[model samples]
Target: MKLLSSEIKNKVLESMVKIIDRERHNIIKANKKDLDAFNREDQALFDRLVVNEAKVDGMIKAIEEVRVQNDPVGNVISDLTLDSGLKITNKTAPFGTILIIYESRPDVTIEAAVLAFKANNKILLKGGKEAINSNLILEQCWHEALVENGLSKDWIKLLHLKREETQEFLRNPSEPLDLIVPRGGERLIKFVKDHASCAVLISGRGNNFLYVAQDANWEKTLKVILNAKTDKISGCNALDKVLINKNIPNYEAKLKELQHVLRRANVNILVDENIGNILSSENKIQEEDTWYEEFLALKIVLAEVSSLDEAVEKINTYSGGHSAAILTEDKNKAAQFMEQVDSAAVYHNASTRFTDGGQMGVGAELAISTDKLHHRGPLGLKQLVTNKYYVFGDGHVRV
Candidate 1:
């Protein structure tokens, strides 16, 4: 009976969604009863999202503004001609359903739903264990939007399940999962890539890099590294390693300055013995934390390379194929690093922290596509749709 009810709810939601745009701003403020439901049911979730409610609202407002100002990616391209008297054009279409399985990041629940909703796709969100309460709150927000607009909430349904359930879904692909985008550590994404039968988008982990080049301005380098690692140590964009040139002037003092900053921020520093002597204090970085570790906290690895070539090789070898940055005053050297390092977002004279879909000017974010295939960089609304050939022929079959 519950399954039957869910099917009914899904049909209702799909029908309503197909007609929502006719009314401008269909999602309005919720009524008193709805607000009460939000408050009373699962209050722990309220604690999580409510703490950052204003910030979430700001993101929503920004998304809505972008939705209004920007044009949709889909348009009928009808300018193809053939010598055999046939016109062939192409059209864009949305993926019908997108099943997302992500780890405990509350904001992603909202992010995925908004992106899917805007792209005219149905979404089934199954957030991992740590964010059960937080995900519930975010799911409720979408439900309110649907319910207040006189629509069913199935458009963005949250599959209430535990970690085991998600593993089952990945291992057994009987469900109608059009695409599965995994967002978490190497373990999570690897499980999905190995088990899931459907097409998958690897939102690979961030073993990102930052290089302090020989010509880099010491002051700017300090500010950039701090911003890169300290902006939000938990984010995927944060720098995991700092590569300094061995031949630079005041290298010891510069290294010491950064060490102090990392220590003050409460980050454990793993330094090579050469650079270890320069620091004011001694704090060791564990072997596990030193190599390809996304600390997501106050932590960094310091390594001294003999030359620029060595620095590039180290990054290319150890990088998680995510964002990488080089702080350098020398334009030529920066360009060289950008070209040599293999990652999705190669930044220069800037922090790797800005490697996000929203920051990259997409109205809605899907995830960073780590797999190099149909999509590679940050997945956005455009990546959500694909092309289909629309061949036009008047009384002309195959010649």
Candidate 2:
């Protein structure tokens, strides 16, 4: 809970950047062990588990980004001198200790720790068992960085607890837990919420939706859809559902064109009743639950909407409150959809993929938060700290 000077924190991050670069080969080797032991059936999970040279470079870049940015803690929010001769100043403060439970991604082990440590919060990483080896090596790198900067290894610890033990720890944490971020699917979020006795920030689940308005530019719609859905299937910002306005010019033909494009890209499509009629050969959505599903794969759902209101309503109801987009040349409709859709990030003629932290210019993020309590979008360095009121009074007392 001690506040570290910005110089020391940046020094640690500098060491981390050099250390990660030097240990890139060993890091890749450790990841190879995880990749070999992992089941390849879940392609999305498999892709997330891979930590190649590019990923290591990305890790180094993340540290560098956070390192150069302004330290988030102690920035003054507001200062006021009351009429009663009292001075009160609200300033940013670290959250003390944070626990982030995530799956597959070993980069979170670095990104989360760097952000939290830089913000003066001790982070406890609870990565999935599948990436144990990779995370262990990454944690070792973090420890080396911390020790090199004369900081405690406890500043960035990794929790190695099993399912039942995690449940118990969540229910009755051994140490103080200021904030808990569950960065995974619904099951994982539910597990953390059901047990954790601290404030929980929801992240990771992304049943993102995109609406193609009747006035949409056909070429742009197709491009956005293709990029959002297929560009990176493992990303949480990846598009999962597409709602096309039925009144769009040449609706049936556009639908067929979309199907063709997706087919060429090897993306499997599921359609609602109306879309099913047009794309008869494609599979129809079997259950209503399909609307709420986050397809973190080469899969997407195509549905029809009669109006912009309907598209907004459907997205608000079924989406994971992550990201939503409207493709329309009409500024009015785009503004309406952007205003009405209940999501952390809403786009106007842009791909839902822009919901990412780095893409949105937040630098290295802890996660893309879906929760609305403290934050609702990218959990970046600035978003990691809460506020504290510092009061200075001349022997004043409330009457």
Candidate 3:
């Protein structure tokens, strides 16, 4: 892969910012076409498909944020000299080419490309058919920026392939795929993993869990739970499960209060047997599979746990390894829960909504990776590059 100078990359980003601003109307108009064609029955998917003026502004902001950040290529990671006069240095390098398959969201077409291009990696976007119009317009904006900066449009591209074609391409990609990121639900991730020949980075599934410990501040716990569950139901960090300690003070009353709060918010609740006895009117979970499901909707499951260990075990077993939180006034207990949750981002008395790249101070991100290899959390500009070693040796031979 050809290395691009930081100046040139930033120039492209600057050009992209201006182009998106100028083409804001066209972008919105194109997105309207997608929204018109989409099925509104899937509220979460529809929410993701909408690209209003605010969404356009968000895209511009994402590009600008990445533009001002430091370039992530060729930075020294480590340097050492052996006794045999051999000098070795490790430096950050781009992953060459990255393919990210995502669903519904058009903003990803902007965020993913900007991050990968700024890091000097070419990006291939395979957005869902539902957002085709939005993605096409966004891809054109990217191309204009690249061309303005004397770079190949191939640096950022959108793949327009059918389902069968995508499957075949993943199995035998026409070009080398240094890495693949499946930024969607379990089915999509599984599809990519089962077919892709390259390294696949798992992301986007979010059956996140939050624990309310016995000593948790009731007011703070309620506030965090409301925001994490409803702030943006379409978000990958949205809370799907809440485990309340059975020994908490006034457990039945608190569960009733929770049911009232959730009902007022119009959030559908599912409960385990223990919680069901208290909130009898609420729906009971029908299958074990629901525990592992990432509901990108206004739905959540409330269950009871006897101890902190049980809470931790349940989250680790059922969560998507995305985000988890604990609400507790006890510092030691909060620390224990945060340490044992085994998610990408574990929080103490904070909402799982904070797992986002922007919220976590990562600016714009490619995805919130759940994969432990290569990277685990936000795939930001700095995290996009792998490491390369350079050796300088003169008249040195290994025995």
User: lDDT (CA) for every model shown?
Assistant: 0.69, 0.93, 0.92
Model 2 TM-score, 2 decimals: 0.99
Off by over 4 Å in 2: none
| Model 3 Cα shift for residue 350 (angstroms) | 0.7
RMSD (CA, Å), candidate 3 to true, equals 0.9
Better by lDDT, candidate 2 or 1: 2
Give the Cα error of residue 132 in candidate 3, in Å. 1.1
State the lDDT at 54 in candidate 1.
53
Cα lDDT tens digits for candidate 2, 156-178: 99999999999999999999999
What is candidate 3's lDDT per residue for 1-399, written digit by digit as tens?
899999999999889989999999999999999999998999998998899999989999999999999989999999999988899999999999999899999999998889988999989999999999999999999999999989898999999999999999999999999999888778899999899999998885999999999988999988999999999999999999999999999999888998888889999999999999989998999999999999998899999999999999999998999999999888999889888888899999999998878988999999999988888888899999999999999988899
Q: Candidate 1, which segments miss by more than 4 Å at Cα?
A: 1-51, 69-73, 147-152, 280-289
Error at 290, model 2, angstroms: 0.5
Instruction: Quote each prediction's TM-score.
Output: 0.82, 0.99, 0.99
lDDT rank, highest first? 2, 3, 1
Tens digits of per-residue lDDT, candidate 1, 10-72, equal 343343333332211222221212333454343323333232435455445534533543323
